[model samples]
Target: MTVNDVKMILDACILCGEQYIGKEVHTACGADMMSDVLAFVKDQSVLLTGLCNPQVIRTAEMMDIVCIVFVRGKKPDEAMVALAEESGIVLLSTDHRMFTACGMLYEKGLHGGASD
Candidate 1:
């Protein structure tokens, strides 16, 4: 799916990276643990997470994720947004819980960061 598709799936806002909305996403990962994000995610353009902190952006940067979706209405601070913006990572927020958000996107064709 594309970043536009991800925005639609999560009903997200373009908190940053407005220029990257057309980018395509082949995979995704959902987690609050930065360690898990670093260890498990691979080639995922979008990150669904509730950890609205600087480390979240750092993890996305390290993993090369193009976008991050903050779930359950968790709003990230300006510092986190600045970090994401600097890293060229799009940021978004949604009210949906983690499970529901991941399920919706998965049902719509978003896959985990793994291949057969």
Candidate 2:
């Protein structure tokens, strides 16, 4: 699904990377574990997490993720937002919990990465 589609699906607010709203994301992974994200995610363009930190942006950078959805009303701090802006990653905030956000995206045809 496109980034705009994700925003619509999750009723999310754009935190940054407004220019990337039209980008397409084929896969999504929802997790708070950065290691799991780095190790298991492949070509996954979107990350859904409740963790709000600069490290989350770093993990997204490592995985080449283009979009990040902060679930459960979590908001990234200024540093995290600046980092994401610098890295050209789209940041979205949604009131839905991680599980609900993931399910919504999945129902809209966005799938998770392949399992090991």
Candidate 3:
């Protein structure tokens, strides 16, 4: 799926990187633990996380995640957004909780690479 597909399915708002809405996303991972995300390596490009911090952006950068969805209506501060912008990561916000958000996207055909 693609970022546009996710936004359409979840009715998410692209808080940043509106230009990347059309980017293709091969895989997604839902996690708040930065270490968990770092420990695994796959073709994951979409990160669905509730963790709001500068380190989240850095983790995404290191993982080459193309987009981030802040679930449970969580909002990152301006600094996080700036870091994401600098790293070219698309940011989105949604009311769906973490599990539900991950399930919805999974139901729509997005997977966390090889892991179930």
Best by TM-score: 2
Which number leads on lDDT? 2
Query: Which pairs clash inside model 3?
Result: none
Q: Per-residue lDDT of 1-116 in model 1, one digit per residue for the tens?
A: 88888889888777888888888888888898888888778764688998877888888888889889999888888888888888888888888999999999999988885562
Cα error, candidate 2, residue 61 (Å): 0.6
Give per-residue lDDT, candidate 1, residue 57: 86
What TM-score against the true fold does each predicted structure earn?
Answer: 0.93, 0.95, 0.95
Q: Write the per-residue lDDT of candidate 3 for residues 37-104, one digit (tens) a residue.
A: 88773554788988999989999999889899999888899988988899889999999998999999
- lDDT per model, in order? 0.85, 0.91, 0.87
10 residues in a row with least lDDT, candidate 2: 107-116
Order of the predicted models by TM-score, top scorer first = 2, 3, 1
The candidate 3 region of ten consecutive residues with least summed lDDT is 36-45
In candidate 2, position 98 carries an lDDT of 94
> Positional deviation of 111 in candidate 3, in angstroms?
0.6
Clashing pairs in 1: none
